[model samples]
Target: MTDFRSRCIAPEPLAGLFCAIPHPTGVEICAATGPDFLCLDGEHAPIDRERAEEMIRAAQLHRVPVIMRVPGHLPDSIAGALDSGADGVLVPRVSTADEARAAVAATRYPPVGVRGVGPGRAAGFGYRIPDYLATANSRILLAIQAETPGALENIEEISTVEGVDVIFIGPGDLGVTLGALGPEGRPKLMAAITRITKVSRAAGKAVGMFCASPDEVQGWRELGITFFLIGNDARHLADAAGAAVARAREGF
Candidate 1:
């Protein structure tokens, strides 16, 4: 599997899709299609650790790295995702450098941060604890969301936070927060995204964001942001299914 962090920082853009179906089969299907990575959504989906672990195992079977978008910044949430053997953790709503630091702290171990050691799946069930501990702090990618106005104001500081591999912009929530939804608000939202990308690049951090359509990829890439999560499992399924049904109805 390509290292998630390396993929994020590489010059070529990393393309990924969010797997929100909360099932191993769903993840397997997406992985088989081959993306640079897969983000299993724990924030909006009903996925628990067991399910996330199962999904991770499924994706790794295809040698696809997985980043778990944990529901919150709490230690336990981050720990659960990492323990499930997620390639990284994406913490949402991280508005300040302090919150970013806290998120990274929970992700690293001991002297580096506060994460307690555990012989979880990522450690090969206690068999590879030493190796896992020796490398995890560096191997695991730490991505924090910049979705609020506060995050926009503090983008420079947050981007400079150590161990924060990717500064992901949650355009949807941010649009809502900035009242930058729809046509009128899109310019405002894009402006915020542009600012985040600019500051993050200056700080040598990878920038990521959610794109509603594939067409937006190249445009965003021009902004020096590489990581992108465009579309999701549910949307793909629904679109294909609907298209098929529409075709069948036309025949009828």
Candidate 2:
């Protein structure tokens, strides 16, 4: 029987991968490599229901928490990810409090949230001695990505969403909206991130994001960021692979 996860460190980095690679072994291999946490792309990646389960199992074995990023806010997909055993979930493009609440509801079961409860792999089935429900709500890291001009405008409202444990800054998408990343020294994007973090901390929620380097992380950390995700699987692999290829070609 596996131990129930009472809590997991939220993933984060200044700039990290969103892991597009398919296959459980690939996920497993990436997990073993250790790069903050893996945001399993249940949304864009070619992973089906069965493979999601396989990947979760492997993540558990490696003792690395996996955040399942659902394709959208669809109820069924959200329900499936939680039931399948992801440590937490990252709902993308969440621009409203209602959508954020819906995502939180999908991950929990009654009282705390609205997820259906059942003895399954995530709970170690009936084998799990300690009740999985004992602290599931606090254990589940509910995060919503604030990635658009709409979300930034509603940053305070979105940050106040109930059951939303963390607010992540999707700066890339937000950056384009405010025009080229360099202009105004990213004041617009910076303001959005700061607003979300400010409101979240005031409301007693965690703040996190996808940081590219340690400097970005340090900046966010100073801003009270906690459950951040550093990078993804595919980027790590691509970076390493590219360097290897470059080194090999250098002889030519």
Candidate 3:
């Protein structure tokens, strides 16, 4: 397993992409391209626990770390992802410190948080349970999204949450909530992004974002984000296929 939690806090930017295609083959394709990590899109895709485990296995074949973007902060969702051997989870729609706390809690096992014990794939099916449980609390990365006005308002408190690792910015959702979409709202959107990054960093947590392209990575990195999910498999396939058809049509 890649030590993805360590990568999240490293000074150099860690670039990643989302694997929303819901298949091990789709995950393997992205893994072959060599992203720093891949986030399984459980929140937006039709990925269920079984599919997620297969996807995790596919990424692990290439030694790529996998983090699931679970549908919610519920313990069941978090536990299922972890049991499948995902390196971490990204909990969406976190709007307060309490929500952030719940996310982290669900990722960890007692004394630290409420995560229950299980002899799943992460533990080598009971064989490595001792070691897996011993280290899981520190090993699993728990990132909570800062996408709503409530999160922006409580950025500091959320950043200060004890076990929260990364404060991931869901730009689209955040913009929608802030009424900050389009060119006219760009400034407002950026301001929110900047503030989240700054505060999270100040509290000693790494900041992450869902970037539209690689071009956006460095600009955000300069502002203190070190983790990024740039684009997704579907977009890549669509763009390449569309361009090929467009070029072919030019000859017609």
Candidate 4:
């Protein structure tokens, strides 16, 4: 009923998946399937601004929230995503407190943040945000990613960066950083995820992680990780496509 990314920021903890591969149809399909949010992949997936805007529009039209995971952790990139009307911005590989601070500052306007305020898609394409300055910071959700070894080592500090709404651990990269990406929930990796949840909760921010399966979600939830990204659109489609072909071959 409520779709963020276009109107409100961090209105709720968006429950959803990231679509690394951008096909409008796939974006539309994810919307119909009904994840609370959909993150447009620009960092790992090849995509353009035009396409990202379209997907954001699509997701909003279908009542699914959209977050854009930008390629860089730079302020300009973050401001652009915010201006593009992203419900939130998931910054990748932010291992330090400064990077986290910069991401927040760039998304909010002066007095709260140094973001340059002007009219754009974020402002209803030049017709919105009548009170953009007064309310933007309260609405914008800032997510800083922890996927590197340095990030894991400094989880407490990273989690405490002011204005950060959530701290998400990149599972694959996180495990690889810890040198154990083979299984889903290795003891060490699970502990790392737990640490993030604990630190973020103590700092008054939400903690989140993306897992390969729903089975993996419950445990993370028990660990106080509320924002659980189940999986991605491309991965699910690919797996289903392969399985369907295999079944047809078997019938043959």
Candidate 5:
């Protein structure tokens, strides 16, 4: 398995595309597209554990890291993704330091955290249990979403939590919180994003965010965001298909 956590903290920037289609083939295609990692969306997408594991396997085959955005900051939610062989779990709606710590603990085993032992795919189906256990705590990456006003207020404290690797900003939800969206709200959203990135960097943590376009990615990159989850598979497909149809209608 790729040591995604190590790559995340490396000096170079890490870029990843999101997958919301819940299919291994889509994940494989994204991995082949050559991003540093791929984030499987379980929070907004209808991906179950089985499908998530399949996607992880696909990404692994391509030697690309896969991080799942689990639905919430719950033990089962976080563990399900890790146990499914995901390189890490991105817990959404993490609004406080305690919530961030809980998300981190869920990804680890006892003493360090409360994750239970299981001979699942992550352990190579019992064959690599000893090896897996020996390094799982440190190997597994943990990220929490800083998407709401509450999360923004406690961003510093959350970033300081031990075991937390990334602090991802959810711009859409954040815009909602700030009562700003679209072009009119871009300034406020950008300000919040900059603040989150600065705070996370100050705490020695990686900053991550979602970007739908190259322009957005460039903008965030300039602000010192090394970890990026770009456009999802579904949107990419739809956009391509729509463009293709439009070209055909234009008769070359």
Candidate 6:
């Protein structure tokens, strides 16, 4: 399996795409599209455990690393995704260092964390239990979303959490939280993004964020954000369909 966590921390930047459609075929399609990794959006999407597990398998078949974004920081939410063979878990709505720690703990096993011992597909269904246990602690990535104002205030502390791998910013949510939703609010949003990136980088952590377009990715990359989750499958599909419809109408 690819060590996506290590790649994220590597000298160069890493780019990835998001999959919101809750199906194995969608996972396979995204994997085939070839990003460095894929974030399975279980948080906003209606993806359940069984579908997630199947998607994980689909990703593995295509040799793509997958990180499931759980709805919350609950132990079950985190563990279930890992057990289903996801390479990592992204906990959303993390507003404090404590919540960041809890997210990390949920991804780790005993002693280091309270994560239980049901390995399932991640451990090769008991066949690779020893191998899994020996490396899971270091292998699994734990990313916490830092989108709210409170999270930005505690950004440094959250970044310094021992097991926290990535401090991913939800720009859309952050913009709403900061009351800066349009072009008029670009300055404030950029300032907040810059601050979070600088603090996170200073703490020796990788920074990630959502990029709606290539322009946003370039801007964030300049701010030292290496991990990027670019557009989702649904949006891409809609845009393509809309374009085709417009072209057909013009021809007719």
> Between 4 and 5, whose TM-score is larger?
5
**Residue ranges of candidate 2 with Cα displaced over 4 Å:** 1-17, 124-130, 179-185, 213-215
Taking the tens digit of each residue's C-alpha lDDT, what string does model 5 give over 87-108? 8988888999988888878899
Residue-level lDDT tens digits of model 6 in 1-252? 567778877635877888998888988988987778899999999999999999888888889999999998789989999999999988999999999888888999989999888648888887898899899999898888888999988887888899998889999999999887899998998899889989999999989989887577887777889899889988888888999999999978
Cα lDDT of model 1 overall?
A: 0.91
Clashing pairs in 3: none
Tell me the tens digit of each residue's lDDT in model 3 across 72-146.
Answer: 878999999999999999999999988888888899899878888878999998899999998899889888899
lDDT of 4 by residue, 89-167 (tens): 8899998888888888888887878988778797877677776656677777777788888887887887778888878
lDDT, residue 182, candidate 5: 89
What overall lDDT, based on C-alpha atoms, would model 4 receive against the true structure?
Answer: 0.78
Model 4: how far is 112 from its true place, Å?
A: 1.0
Record all residue pairs in model 5 with backbone atoms less than 3 Å apart, i.e. clashing: none
The worst-scoring run of ten residues by lDDT in candidate 4 lies at 3-12
Candidate 5 regions with alpha-carbon error over 4 angstroms: none
Name the 10 consecutive residues with the lowest summed lDDT in model 5.
7-16
Q: What are the per-model C-alpha RMSD values against the true structure?
A: 1.0, 3.5, 1.1, 2.8, 1.3, 1.2
Candidate order by decreasing TM-score: 1, 3, 6, 5, 4, 2
Cα lDDT tens digits, model 2, 83-195, are: 67787788889888888888988888788667777766667765662477776676766778888777777777877777786677777777876573887757767787788
Error (Å) of candidate 6 at residue 206 is 0.5
